[model samples]
Target: MTSITRLFDFPYYQQDKYISIPDALVTKQNGVWVKTSTEEYISKANAVSRALLRMGVKKDDKIAIISTNNRTEWNIMDIGVLQTGSQTIPIYPTISEDDYEYILNHSGAIYCFVSDIEVLRKINLIRNKIPNVLEVYSFNAIEGCKNWVELLKIGEDETNQYLVEEQKNKVQTEDLATIIYTSGTTGKPKGVMLSHRNIVSNVLNSAPRIPFEAGKSRALSFLPICHIFERMILYLYQYYGVSVYFGESIDKISDNIKEVKPTVITAVPRLLEKVYDKIYAKGTELTGIKKKLFFWAIDLGLRYEPYGANGVWYELQLKLARKLIFSKWKEGLGGNLDLMVSGSAALQTRLARVFAAAEIPVMEGYGLTETSPVISVNDMRNKGFKVGTVGKVIDGVSVKIAEDGEILCKGPNIMMGYYKDEKLTSEVIIDDYFHTGDIGEIDAEGFLRITDRKKEMFKTSGGKYIAPQLIENTMKQSRFIEQIMVIGDGQKMPAAFIQPNFDFVKEWAKIHKIEIGTTNEEITADPKVIARIQEEINRLNDKFGNWEKIKRFELTADIWSIEGGHLTPTLKLKRKIVMEKYIDLFHKIYN
Candidate 1:
């Protein structure tokens, strides 16, 4: 059996030495779940490699893929590009067209593959700008775009199999596998260059931390595969021979979860927050015994402690909660979900505890695109899990807290460097350690807890420092607050610009018979709505220092979203942009 070293070797490894199942990759097509076998997966990938070879693709050449969702075609194209000793540039489909032009030209990509017509439309808008791209292909056949099936037909002859083999053999584990452009909160995106070893080592090391039966577990993948967190998990799924079902889209995740009945999935904190809010909102609709039991279960969940640390009486009540109210919660998420790995941002500790109490554990991890993304993660096995922390560092990876509380990581999983920016790369990777730019501390038990982004922390005129994330995460636990950003970096006192839970406010208004208007603008401007939100702020503010508490705030009439230029693709607030967008609100709160 060939050892799995290169990124392309995962599928081949699964097919040859590992379990080869009939349903290796599944995708929902035309309202049906379509399965692609291991043999077919490899065959199509080889065909893609041969076709690229025929198209004059050479070693070190770049190919680009932009997809709106995770699908079988994306995986096939990824392996195909890597097999030809070429690097694949995976771009976020939601980014602006200017970014598309910059990345395509910067990477010197000779060919481009897009998932759907929306992506094709974006590419066509910048087609003239990206002159390096000789041709464009689409996974979904569009009117004027070249279809990927053409490549399959072009490489139908088996006579060229030896040439694909020649290229595969020449490819080393240290060779560049892909260039991932991070969706920065500010400025132009930097292309993070990762080698085959960087990702493969991360997969192998991080695999054991997640407990799943190799061939028996089914995974529902909805997160964008373009991100290393999800992409690495995809390769991990392949490595374990687990069958993967790609969700149609984010809007269809709940329905897809029901259809697939997957045992494991990956999620961001925002998605989980939405799920919890929806469930909580439904609970509010219940009355009498059901409503009492619902709140009882939630109260029990919020104080959850693992390893029977909450005592036997609490355990008994938790068992009752799980059997009654939490069981329905599980059913809503397809009933088979045993684990969810949360990354890309700090997950609220209460969300982690409550979900674990419901028997679906959310193991939150922390890392950036430069580290092949997994530095430390919470694992349930062997007491490696921690509620408020990001858990212990994975095996073969070492993490240390710097003098100023920055998390420094050193491991084989670290990226080679930022593509084409040596000065910027050298600034972060010093003394063989990658500076994570996140302020954190490793506990006595070795659990890492992130406090805030180093660059985001600020001091008021009073000379006391404030970590906005800590305040923001705590404030968001309020049912009335949907999103928030704490301000007053160099001002007199800490304040906030908030986007209230507009839907929840409407529901609350109905229950209380308040005369709040229907539109967001009218609702935000309502004095009654403002007073109620102030009550919530006063309640949650008791947990913070007086200096850190939000002294004043103004509500936004619109949702903060990626399309609004208020958030990054990963759902983190573009703080500068948010402040600029709400400058009037800022002045109203401070002045």
Candidate 2:
């Protein structure tokens, strides 16, 4: 039994704890690792808050932060902003210039903090257009701009420490702490106003459910801090005094995990899928008994059930399999990882089951930015952890399936409203229930299984409704598919645009003695390649209904990406953008 006492109401969690712990919070500066103790973090944050106050920043003022996860500074600035009763507006540094201008203007942010030179350049590009933004500060000490450290130095005062403490006490739980602008798939981003009460409610309610040791557990923070999921989880980690090591970059996470050997981590499904694919690719390289054993271990894992025992003989084999294969699998994720938390998208059930069986448990969860980011999560500590579902509705939250199957949630975690968009907010919130726009069903066991996005479901000319997400998820199970989009709204039949897994296809072609051309265009146009992809599509078609079956498909060499505007930052497909970009491919298939 773990000895972590969970809290139910964390009103002044960060303010109180940062003072009490006085322990190190790790960060990377340049190429060296540095530890800023909690006391140092609090002092720096207070000094910065005083600097902002000196610069005429008042309570309820909107301050914006456009940065990647520069761990120490990000957390300190957030604390500073909130302590002064100013709301922080976090924007993804990768956002387009237009979005940057719009968000800054709409939020009326008077001061902005940027991460690096490029981010500073982006702000300067639109500085004149966004008239309300008074000044830009950099996390990095770039030329001609105020740096965050300077703010701390400018306002540092030993005598005024009591005033900072008073400021912390003055903050009410109901005060607005941040306005998070969600870059959703379908439309312009909306500013989600989350009060201190909203986020603290989530932290307190959701923390006890996650099984982690207080002082023993360590987490590798790599996900974007601008995301509420990561931010909320950070607060939970702080509450438990869990040591956190920030990854240098997204590309460096694997290396960081091996070095840090963290016990916990959070991720989106895309990252997990990539990890699964990498593991599967490694299995293909083995020979004879080793290859057989590798696949056998995976098969056993996929058959694993959390709730029911698989008999003594089966358990014995599982133990052997764990020793021979799964243990090494855990080593790849850093030997200490007990479990992982997956959110922002639905995890593939196959991957979920296989990982669970491999002893590297993945607790899949579900929610949106509006609900403090977590509405339900599978508790891996419990026997009822189901692979296909997002687990049960969390405590302090109520979920209902509407007549049309949209998931409706009523919770204290729900956003106060869309900032400056009352009419838009009213459309989604009715009588205190927030319409989640996701179509899902709750089982008798209380597991919530999300099937499709209500807006993404479409009908064919034959009047058959097809859930594109269902077909897409099934198609992704194929080894050749890297990405796929299902299209047929008002058309005679469904068609698909698929991006093939280049590395897998190259390896396969070499083994089969098929010659693919050097260029992507030539490779995609190859008859053998097209024929092989079609065969995989045909196999998947057997699993779907007549209307949902993909009758034709066009293979593409191009992988969809955030920069390409075909995918959101979370990797959810921008269907509308994809349709526009590939209209010629769809025309070729349909016409």
- For TM-score, the strongest prediction is 1
True-structure lDDT of candidate 1: 0.93
- Weakest ten-residue segment in model 1 by summed lDDT: 13-22
Error of 1 at 203 (Å): 0.4
Candidate 2 per-residue lDDT, tens place, 59-157, comes to 889999988654778888888887777889999888789999999999999999998899999888988999999888899889999888888886776
Candidate 1 deviation (Cα RMSD): 0.9
Per-residue C-alpha lDDT of model 1 across residues 1-591, encoded as one tens digit per residue: 658999999998888855467888999888989999888999999999999999999999999999998999999999998999999999989999999999999899999999999999889888889999999999997998899999999888878989999999999999899999999988898999999999999999999999989878899999998999999999999888889999999999989999999999999999999999999989988999999999999999999989999999999999999999999999998989999999999999899999999999999998899999999999988899989999999889999889999989999999999899999999999999999899999889999999999999999999999999999999999989999999998899999999999989998999899999999999999999999999999999999999999989999998999888898888999999999899998888777
Error of 2 at 272 (Å): 0.3
- For residue 117, what is the lDDT in candidate 2? 94
- Please count the clashing residue pairs in each candidate, in the order shown: 0, 0
Candidate that scores best on lDDT: 1
